[model samples]
Target: MRSSFARSGLLTAGLCAAVALSTPALAQDKIKVGLILTLSGPAAALGQQARAAFEMALKDLGGKLGGREVELVVADDELKPDVAVTKVKGLIDRDKVDVVVGPTFSNILGAIAKPVTDAKVFLISPNAGPSPLAGKGCSPFFFATSYQNDQVHQVSGKVAQSRGYKTLYLLAPNYQAGKDAIAGVKRDYKGQIVEESYVPLNTLDFQSELAKIAAAKPDAVFTFMPGGMGVNLIKQYKQAGLADRIPLLSSFTVDESTLPAQGDAALGMFAGSNWAPDLDNPQNKAFVAAYVAQQKAVPATYAFQAYDAALLLDGALKATGGKTDDKEALRAAFLKADFTSLRGAFKFSRNGFPVQDFYLTKVGKRPDGKLETQIVEKVFSDYVDSYLPECSIK
Candidate 1:
């Protein structure tokens, strides 16, 4: 009888140990996230910041999600929607990723939103937030830490409108975001647009375009060209002396990453940026210090937003105990105001967009060894896009 009782106790111990072992393995398998970003091409420099933020987040969080170590798969979308779509499909069908992180461009965002959502996967857009996605057209599975495409430009337009800048010329790359930007500026600013030009993406030489702008003689020129194109345009604009005759106002296209390349040419130019390299807040300072320390590179708003998105996801994972496989649970956690990000604290609205800040920043050399985006004007402090009514989701 004593031997039998001892055997029974041993059996109970074995069963309990087996269950405990299985629990961790099961939790670890619950979350798998895939990253899609422009790791190359003209936007490659911008991608560097996003990549850095992601790596830091993983390291800081000990590679865990929801009490389980996250299984992360990263792919370079190369700024091509087709490439982005292929990578996303592979991640879902082959890798069985539970959630998809991003595709930076708004055009690319629009292309991939349906596929991931249709597959019952959440597509967390860290950067792209087009007006269409923010409006009655919004999707339940599509969430953005990034501000709406128009919100920043709307602020720019409002600034222009307030200043009574009547004669303006608009330039953008021939793409969805560019078109959306043009429309956004037009939405608020009632002014004489001398001409609207759509240049090819990544066109470095703008001598001819500058000549036309100089000839038209608009009071101001508003442009939407990101990455290399922004660098090239601003450089040539200075060379052509357009910066003296007409103040160049742009949005998102000329922040920290491109400003360094622009050098003295970017000085005194006004840009509508969500964050600057020299923001006074503790959150911005820490993020800038950490990024430069880790990657030996300055980060852009693109990187900042991406970093914010990861931090947001980390908070959600913890709230859900790493059980990201439950779509409803994960979504609820994301919606729950549990995140504390480098941008301070932010949360998604019912429609999956941010109530954030938009500032009109000026490019200038501060005392620091970096190009600074000084807040010359603020468009909105606690801003939510007016088009949130367009979102299909509650």
Candidate 2:
């Protein structure tokens, strides 16, 4: 009887050990995603739109991607590159996330790209695709869901040329993206630049720049100010009485994100984008309806791009059977870009940036008394970034 009792106790102990060992394996199956964005300060709206759309997409997917539960960790970069690196490192080393998304501005992308990709974890940018990344610095693990920094600006430049603008004045915030913006405008614009002025990033007051524009008296003005900066510029430009005289042509300067504050001042303003709320397509119509219903605000390019990023991840994970252990397999899956884009007809260029269409969009008041960007015309079809040839990724 004693031997039988001892054998039963041993068997029970072994069963408990097996259960303990299995628990960790089950936990490991969950997909951890870290979202890093500039969620504070003047540019907060951009990041907020991205975060909201990404969350909305995940919820639409039933809180899972590729049939596996997701653990999402969100961090605010506060528009600081140093802060972004610290938070992203924590997400990588401490949280052990499978992927990292965001940092809405180009400067932050420049800061965190190396650390995240060097660790063999994928980094996807919904916005802020800097030129260096699209060129010689391209990495197998970094993919940009948004257009390269210069592509949208290139669209605006083409618009300026088509509109018969002879002498143009250029303005942008001083940053890597600002430099890229100027370069893109120059690429397609064959006009004489009266003045090329760059203000410090996030500078709200544009009085001095306005005076310069007034003095130069260029036929049209092109700028790339975004977020709160855009809000202030549009208002100040109208206040300075330059709206009617010097037409404002830009990208990211007067869009859905800043239109609420700009109000009627942004009416008839032309901007360049890959997608707009009024884009006529089944996927875009559905997305716009859902976003308007839930968010109660017009969706911006930031929102659409971020939502596309989620779809990209879902498709890649589904292809890999929800496995992230093999980095090369995951990279290959991402390169496939098997998901439908809100912008319609999106495929990854060899350098991991999008090869997609661009449009000339104009801000207009909706029938429902809301301001939104409406598509004017297709600017570029299947537009590949010029830097693609410089990238050795092939």
Candidate number with greatest TM-score: 2
List lDDT for all candidates, in order.
0.81, 0.93
> For model 2, how does the per-residue alpha-carbon lDDT over 262-305 read when each residue is reduced to its tens digit?
99999999998998999888999999899999999999999999
TM-score per candidate: 0.91, 0.97
Q: Give the runs in model 1 whose Cα sits over 4 Å from its true position.
A: 1-30
Model 2 stretches with alpha carbons more than 4 Å out: 1-9
Worst 10 residues of 1 by lDDT: 337-346
Tens digits of lDDT, candidate 1, 277-393 = 776778778878888788766777888888877777878878877666688888888888486666555777878888877788888775656775677866778787788776667
* Highest lDDT against the true fold, candidate: 2
Clashes of 1: 6
